[model samples]
Target: MEGIEEKLVVSTADVLDYHSILEAVKDCCALFCCLDSQDGYEDKMVDLEVRGAINVVEACAQTESMEKIVFNSSLTAAIWRENICSQKDVDERSWSDQEFCRKKKLWYALAKTLSEQAAWALAMDRTLNMVSINAGLVLGPAVAKKNPLVTMSYLQGAAQMYENGVLAIVDVNFVADVNVRAFEDRSSCGRYFCFDQMVNTEQEAVKLAESLSPLISLPPRYECQGSEVYAERLRNKKLNKLVEGTAC
Candidate 1:
């Protein structure tokens, strides 16, 4: 399929800066996808993201031709109910509690929740046609360069969760594909969860890692078990219907 026009790729060197962001969105449609690792013990990273998103939305509203906006949120924004374990169904309505996030020290979840909330609030206030794509752990072919934190903390060790489990994983390519589709599809609105399958334990992660890349050493199975904070059962009926009419 033909790719999006190069003119559509509005490069903003300073996404978090208000003046710079506003300058980038002038006379153009904007799609803002936010991804940062504030997981584990990090405290203020999430707040930074929330502030940046607000700035971006404000900037976009200033543009005369800015038509739509898309925010990449996460499944972490939802709350997983332990008491309702028997009920496997999950959807966009589920939300992760900020208070619980503070207690558990799940910086990633907190960041996602806060950033999404800020975006929603701003979108409502500004009356911007915005949508957020909430997804699970994204995995695919490794990028050329690997950083220390990504290589050691997140990629190498599988000693986090112990039982139960977290949400599923989506390939990075699938993520990019869906993102482009979301912007092109006029019917796209609100939050959409993206994950191919669920990975419950470190054992399962190791298996997946081995299959995806045989060279990498798999860590001992550990359970980073967390409740499925967001519901995974979101109807992609709109997405499907849109894709049918347009190129993916």
Candidate 2:
């Protein structure tokens, strides 16, 4: 019940009302910040993400029982930027350049990058335990139909990402599992890049297109006949360590 009397000032809103967030997280040991913005409102998405993250982290700061926060973020936050080729390895430490995102009109990437940054800054200032899951384009049953905006936004620079060997995907189930494991395992710290497949080859790209189905258009009777290979630069060593630790 420590810090229970600390009153935080937050803007009024139908959603993300400060009091509501505080009440919901009361006595909770852990928090998962999985936020998304609707596709059409690109202009307001950044503001929404930044504000939502601030409110959530501020609330967690007031809850003494809060042990850790598992923030769900997209790999786009780490992969988009100029001169990606210069970086030998892209990992949790990698961050997308905000200026590049704005210049390219990659609103989703900007939103995630800024929001996650905001959350981390506030969490560190408040001394709250936190970890982030920077996942790739999440794919699962009916993904295109269920999360069209998010899925498409993550793929905005698909060609560049693919060429850089950073275009990747992870199952929705794997993302969920990672979030939970990161929360429960105290050894898990900082950021973990979660992905299962990298779309570097012609065959892999075709498979991704097929998985996204009608959302990603393919030529009539398109077929994948190449086993082309590209060196994948993104790494998930931290995530592997977490999985290994859990299996023990």
Candidate 3:
């Protein structure tokens, strides 16, 4: 866990600026592209998520010192709320429908989905070495606070997504481990769905709701009705193999 704190160099610049991103990645052996906008509804979202991705890939493409880039993406980038009901068992192969997100007012989800897609496309076009970690709602301590929605709104939405397996949960530590493993293990290819737990049963969902109580608003306990939370399953076979058969 000893990061090169002394080696760290700070720079204040815009993520969308290709030159600034290029400068940031200078002399880096590996780049972990884990940038996205929490505001899903604005022009800034497109600028930060889509354009920023392009800028980073462009910078990494130009940087000879860079080896591999680990892109931290999200389950939102893979699941659309509309498709959750109709679809069966969404996994790493799934991509949230852009049209669906736009139609339903899921701006943050759309931004993430588009951002990840653009990165994949540009990475392939440029032939850059990269791996994406499509993580669930990650919980952990933070020196830098996440966006405003990281609390109630995110938890509420995640509760709904959990019903249909559109959302899951993971510890920040576990997510970090996945990132490092994916980087060290050269054979790790494509996208890895990283989550510690997918609350697929009604009982489990209810427990989650009860635990988060006043922090998040969920339906009344009686309103839950049944114990069957069957919409889709999130699979990570490759992730298990990478983690020495410790399945999540």
**Cα misplacement distance, residue 111 of candidate 3 (Å):** 0.7
Relative to the unseen true structure, what is the C-alpha lDDT of residue 112 in candidate 1, on a scale of 0 to 100? 77
**Would you list the C-alpha lDDT of every candidate in the order shown?**
0.63, 0.87, 0.74
Clashing pairs in 3: none
- Estimate, for each residue in 1-248, the C-alpha lDDT of model 3 and write its tens digit: 26988876787657778898888788887877777545425534644678888888889999998888899887778877565767666778889888877776666677778888999999899999888998877766641145435434344356567766666778889998888888888777778888888777777777666555555457554676565866557777768887983322
Stretch of 10 with least lDDT, candidate 1: 153-162
Question: Which stretches in model 1 have alpha-carbon errors above 4 Å?
Answer: 1-12, 37-41, 79-87, 143-165, 201-203, 209-248
For 142-240, candidate 2 gives per-residue lDDT tens digits of 866888887888888898888898999999899998988998888889999999888899998998888887889899988778867878999998899
Residue 6 in model 2: shift from native, Å?
32
The TM-score values for the models, in the order shown, are 0.74, 0.90, 0.83
C-alpha root-mean-square deviation, candidate 1:
5.8
